[model samples]
Target: MKKVAFIFPGQGSQKIGMGKDFFENSDIAKDMISKASERLGINFEKLLFEENDKIGQTEYTQPAILLVSSIANAIFKETSNIKPEFVLGHSLGEFSALVSAGAIDYLDALELVHKRGKFMNDACAGSGAGMMALVGLDDEKVETLCKEQREKGLKVWPANYNMDGQLVLAGLKADLESLIDTFKEAGAKRAIVLDMSVASHCELLQSAVENLRPYLEEFLIDSFEVDVISNVTAKAYNTKEEAIDLLSEQLINPVKYKHSIASKDEDVDAFIEFGNGIVLKGLNRKITKKPTLNVSDMTSLKKTIEALNE
Candidate 1:
C-alpha cells in the first residue's frame, strides 16, 4: 500500500468551477458545500462554479476556496478507505488542513477565513502594496536584500520560502518595483509581480494578525487527529494552541515551505494535492522530486483512487 500524504494548495490555486465536478457527482460533497453556503450566507457554489470577479476579491475568495477544498477532501474520504499518513496546506490552505485533522470545525473555518480575508484586504487598502515571485535567488541573498531594504526604511520582506531559488517577496508596491531591476542584475530568472495587491505573509499584515487572534481563540479546536504541518515553521503542529498561534503569525511571517516539504519527504511514498490546482504537486516535484498527483475534480479523484486500490 502507498503511504500517501495529502497536501492542499493555497490562494492563486483557486479558479472558476473548481469544485463543480465533485459537487455534481457526490452527494457527500454536495451536502457539505450546501451547508457552507447557508452558513456563509452566500451562493458559494455559484461563486465557485461560475466566472465572477468577486471570486478574486480577498474576502469572498478565502471563504469560497475553503468551502471547495473542504468538500473535495470529504468526498475523497467517503469514497476511499486509503487515508493520508500526513497532511499539510500552503498559506491559506492551512485552514483546510486544520479541518482535515478534526482540530477545527469546517463551519468555523469558513467563517474564520472570510474574516481573515477582510482583515488582510483592509490592511492593504490604499497601501499600494503587493507581492512578487523572485526565482534564482537563495535564502541568504533574499534575506540580505530584505534587511538592507528595511534599514533604508522600505517595507519589503520575503513572504514565502517556497523552495531554494524561489522566494516570494511582499511589501509596498513601490519597493517591489525598485527591486525588479536589481534582482534581474543579480541573475534572477524571473522577478514576476503577482496579481494580488495584498502583501500577505509579511509584517504589513501585523495588525491583521493581531485582529484575527481573538477570532481564532474562540474556536473549540480539538487535538489533531492526524499530523498536519505548519507553514510558518515548516514543522508539525504539536498542539491546538500552537496551530492557532502559527495561523495568526502566518499573516506576518514567511512561509517556510521548502523546509516543510523536506521534513516530510522521506516519510511518505506519494504526495497528492487535494484541492483546486496542481500548485502543490508542482512544488513537491520541484522541491522533493517525489511522486505527486492532484485530485482537484471528479475525474482526477477516480484516477487517484484506482491507483491507490492497485
Candidate 2:
C-alpha cells in the first residue's frame, strides 16, 4: 500500500452542524460529544448546531471544532480499514493531530485547547490584533515586504506558510487595515483581511504560549500511535518531549505548513483532510498535484474510501 498522510484542519474550518450526523449515527461519536459537553460544561450540540455568535468566539470555537474533528477521525477509523502513514494539523488542529497519533489524550487535548483559546482571546482582548491573506506574492517577497513594513511601524509578520504564493500575515489591526493597497501596489493579487480578531500563530499570542505551558507540563501524553508532523518546525515530532515545547511555541511562531507538506510529499501517495470543510484539500491542490480528499461527512468519506480502495 502506498503511504497516505492525514491532515486535520485548524480553527477557521469550524461551522454549525459540522459533525451532527456522526453524533446522531454512531455510538462512539455520540459518547465522545457527550463526554466533551460533560467535561467542558458546555452544550456542544447547541453551540455547534444553532445559529449563534458563540461558535465564532475563540473560547467556544476551539473545543467545539476539536470535538467534531476528532469524532470524525474516530468515525473514519471505524468505517474504514485504511490507516494513515502520517498525521498533521495546522495551528489549533495540531491538537487533533496529536489525538490521532495518541500523543495526547483526547479529553486532555480538548481541555487544553479550550484554555488555549481563552488564553489567546485574553491575550488579544485589547491589542486590536488581526490577520490577512496576501495572495499572488512569493514567500521571499512577502517576507521581505512584511519585514520592511514592520520596521516602518506596521509590525506585520508572515504567519502561515500556506503554499508557494499564499501567505497569511499577522499583526496589529490598524497596521493590517492599511496594507490592502500597499500589498496590491507591491504586486499582490488580493490582500484579504480575515474576519479573525486574534492574530494566531504569531508574536501576538505570546502570552497564550506562556499561559499554556503548565497544562502541557501536567498532561500525561503517550507516544505516538502514528507519526505526526510539527506545525512550527515543519518536521516530524518523534517524541513526547519534542511535542510539548513545540505545542506551546506554536502560538508565537509562524505555521510552516508548506515545509511540512513538502517533507512528506515524497513519502506519501495520498493526502486526506479528515475534518470540517475542504480547506486542506484546496491547500493541497496548491501545494502538490497529489490525489487529495476531505472526509468531513458521508459523501466526502465515501469518495475518499473509494479512491483509496481503488
What is candidate 2's lDDT per residue for 1-310, written digit by digit as tens? 6578889888788898888877777898789988888988988889887888899999989888888889888888888878888899888888898888888778988899899999999988988989999889988988888888878877688899988889999988789978889899889999998998899888888888889998987774757888889898888875777888899888888999989988889888988887789888888887887878878877777888888888
lDDT of 1 by residue, 1-310 (tens): 8898888878888789888888888888788888888998988878988879999998888888778788878888888887778888888888888888888999999999999999999888999999999999888987887899899999899998887899999999888988899888878899988888899988889889888999898873757888889898888875778877888889999888878889999998888788888887777778986788778888898888888778
How much lDDT does each candidate structure score? 0.86, 0.86
Error of 2 at 294 (Å): 2.2
Question: Clashing residue pairs, candidate 1?
Answer: none
Q: Estimate each model's TM-score.
A: 0.97, 0.96
Candidate 1 lDDT (Cα, whole model)?
Answer: 0.86
- What is the lDDT, from 0 to 100, of the residue 201 in candidate 1? 89
Candidate 2 lDDT at 123 equals 89
